[model samples]
Target: MKFSPLETPLRTIMTPGPVEVDPRVLRAMCTPILGQFDPAFTTIMNEVMEMLRQLFRTSNRWAYPVDGTSRAGIEALLCSIIEQGDKVLIPIYGRFGYLLTEICERYGAQVYTIECEWGNVFAPEEVIDEMKRVQPKIVAIVHGETSTGCMQPLEEIGRACREMDILLVVDAVATIGGTEVNADEWHFDGVIGGTQKCISVPSGMALITYNDRIEKVVLSRKKVERGIQTDSDRSILAAGKTIISNYFDLSQLQDYWGPRRLNHHTEATSMVYALREGLRIILEEGLTERFDRHRLHERALIAGIEAMGLSLFGEKKWKLPTVTCVNIPDGVDGESVRHMLLHEFGIEIASSFGPLHGKIWRIGTMGYSCRKENILKVLTSLEAVLVYHGVHVNKGEGVQEALKVYIEQSKAIGAGR
Candidate 1:
């Protein structure tokens, strides 16, 4: 087959990330390109920062994008704040916990980790106990661990960090738009999130923030070379210990986005437009409503899956609203079912990593793809595929169970309770 113009099947993206992009975001990106420093473009950039502040529930002036993926934002925060031999405490609950430890070690931070089972989250007392013991300079954690479909509760942990004066950093990629991340209320020194997850934008950009506590550390560790320092140049460069990775340096990135507009790598114009529009759509929906939507769809999806006689894989209370992990019933080929869903139904679902692989299916009700129809479609297709594979399932039960949840919810709303 000759490779002509690129064309692919339209898939219902119900996987962990890179969900179906909002058509409005796509339309926003289609506008003509502008120079990175153009006044109008810079205005949009400013608006994005302010909007991200609202999304993060932060008043921190440093809130902005990392110009890369979610991990990039994590690295930016870690690299800028963590010095050689600075002790960093990380609690391992899932894959992203491992990622936090890996990144901190790479930056020469003395990494101390407390781990829990993959599907389980640490209690506030547990994390606080570790903090009291280690008294590390920073505590890094993942708010939502998509790999295990778990969300770690951070309210108490954040309060502990504030009282102890330990900087609290969170990777909120999986929870930012679809769930609550009270940066200010929770005393988050830094927060990182990807555009692709609940924000409904294409993968490529990251939204992140740093508070004054972290800003103090970053400025103290600053390393800069002044060529023509202006009154507007608030850049903290290579004056002290320089950040290892220049590309991921928060100082330079901050300077560029700051009053000075110091030259850095050219921003990805289209992604900025997409992110702006994505944030706009999220704000329009209202954060509480969007979070409730994710929760409602997740509940409905789980109801449908359970009605089909499949069990969930994790602790019930900690399940992430954006991702659901369904156990593969005995004698069922999890991969085969996923393949059928992809090839036959044109629906994408994810399998787990490491020990959980093949034991569970990770389904996402996130971003633009999280809808009543999408949930019904996948649950129905899954039942069909399961029954066809010789697993016993009642016909039409998945859709029926899911619709029941919607009806109950609507009636409750109607009753104004």
Candidate 2:
């Protein structure tokens, strides 16, 4: 059989994740590969670690990327810290929150959970109170729960965890580049971030940063593999408590990413290039300005959705700026609308999982996808699809309202200037 060159349809991705890759990042992926141990390649590795430290807003000595998607970092952090039957408290507010629980359970952790409604976030005090009651060794929570378009506040929780002497690990996958993720300031022991959503990179790397607190725990369980162990490594104590999975182990990974340069596995050459370029783009744009841009686009999107006579699905105060959840109109076929939007308009949006499956539609405005043109395109296309599906939307009002937001912002900026 013969095959032709690969071709894919162009799409305006507006989904919770895997949103859109920046052209620069895509171009970087095409750069020639270098051997893993080459001095030049190692320099790029060091650059990625430094850029990640800036992106995560941390001064931690340990910062690197896991080779898999965001979940790989989450797994590595959790499994490394958790021993047999250690108590872990995970607050369940959205689908991703439950993922923490699942990872912990699989690693033999005695996981405890507290719950709130899907579209609502728990007050900081609520989680603190539960933490006190559970008295768990670790507290794992999500910063932004894209599953329901809700963002949980972490400042107060982080402070409380510090006072209580509990390890605080956070899943900041959806919030990293689009908003503020202060790793050191928040007192997080470990935090995991993703590339697909707000980093404008492809979904192949998971950025992770850890403070000394987490490093102590991970090193205590360290075990170098026999295949790569040196004569000195044989003398090092294994303590018979090595981490469960070799591929997800952080102790050995640290040495590979660290100055020791001990071999773990061959690095993903193109993916590392993509990540370096992606992080560079973010820092060049300026974190504060980028966050404000996300907020500005979010406001425009919400204005348009409300003008179309559709209600948003979460607490307004806690809605994630990167993703917007809209209550599906009564009698409207949610999948049909999405299908038409994809096929006819060359656009893509996402649907929710579990209870929110058919009740709400998730639209993302993140990183490269968060722009005036893209926002207007999604709102306009969605309005057309909803009206065609017999959902009574105010004709032309969606685009008008969105345009009003953009116009007003421009005027405010001009006046300030």
Candidate 3:
């Protein structure tokens, strides 16, 4: 086969994450590259940090992007804080929770888990009860479970953990820019996010924030290894054992971001540019306004899906606005319908993992892809695919219902004045 310019299909990405990137961010990445330590590049980095602070709604000076994907930031937090045999309690509701357990175990942390149904979130009381029972040093939870499209209530859980003096860590990769998450107000020790989900950027950088309390814990436990030399002036003491992994070490990374400006690995230049521009868009729109857009689009999508006689997989009250899980109709092949939508209609949705693999489809309305036009287009195409698969969906009902929602919302806004 001969390729001209490596053309790809124009897709409306409705998957859980890596939603469509804004064209402005895309264009920003095309600018000429600069050296990692260049003064101009460092200025750009500072600007990115300020934008992230505004987006996360936190005033901590430790806010910055990790050099890898979302999971890298998760690893950085766990590997730095979790010493061998330390107790960690993880409340597992979806696939990412399982990932947390696995990463913790890799660093020799003793992992305990409380399991919930795939489509549900853990109640605050349940989490508190588990904390009392386990008395672990750390409690890890996912604010938004992409696999199930459920949003866990963080305010209560965070408070309970703080009262007990347990460190709280949250995976907010799917929730960060799309929902209302105040890192400081909720008192999270550490929160991790990514550029893909709500920031509408390519997936390369991960963002993590740690409060002073968590930073103190990290500093107190530092120990110098047998062979490694410690700089007398450095604030972070090296662990006696070799740092869990060279690339993921937070001690060196902290120094790099600190006033010391120590050299570490070279940061990804293009990704930094994209992340900076992506966060600029978020701050310009204002975090609250962006969140409202996501919520409205989610409600409209739900209305349309329900009008087509489909049931949502998760509870209505706890569902994440960024991603929606819908049960597959009986007698319809879920994978077949997804393939048809992608190959024929240039749309991409996702199938769930683990227990929900064949049972549901995930439709995402996040970042730049969360728009009225995209929502209507996906609903119309999905209706066609369902009908083609011999599922009993009312013809043209999805789009019509979505339009009705838009009209109702317009009237409500008009009446508010």
lDDT of 2: 0.92
How much is 387 displaced in model 2, in angstroms?
1.3
Q: Write the per-residue lDDT of candidate 2 for residues 212-273, one digit (tens) a residue.
A: 99988887656444333666555442432346798888888999999999999899999999
Question: Candidate 1: where is the Cα deviation over 4 Å?
Answer: 223-240
Clashes of 1: 6
Off by over 4 Å in 3: 1-4, 221-242, 415-417
Each model's TM-score?
0.95, 0.96, 0.94
lDDT of 3 by residue, 335-378 (tens): 99999999999999999999999999999999999999999999
Which model, 1 or 2, shows the larger TM-score? Answer: 2
lDDT of 3: 0.88
Model 1 CA lDDT for position 92: 89
- Residue 134, candidate 2: how far off, in angstroms? 1.5
**Model 2 segments more than 4 A misplaced:** 223-240
lDDT of 3 at 268: 90
Model 3, residue 274: distance off in Å is: 0.6
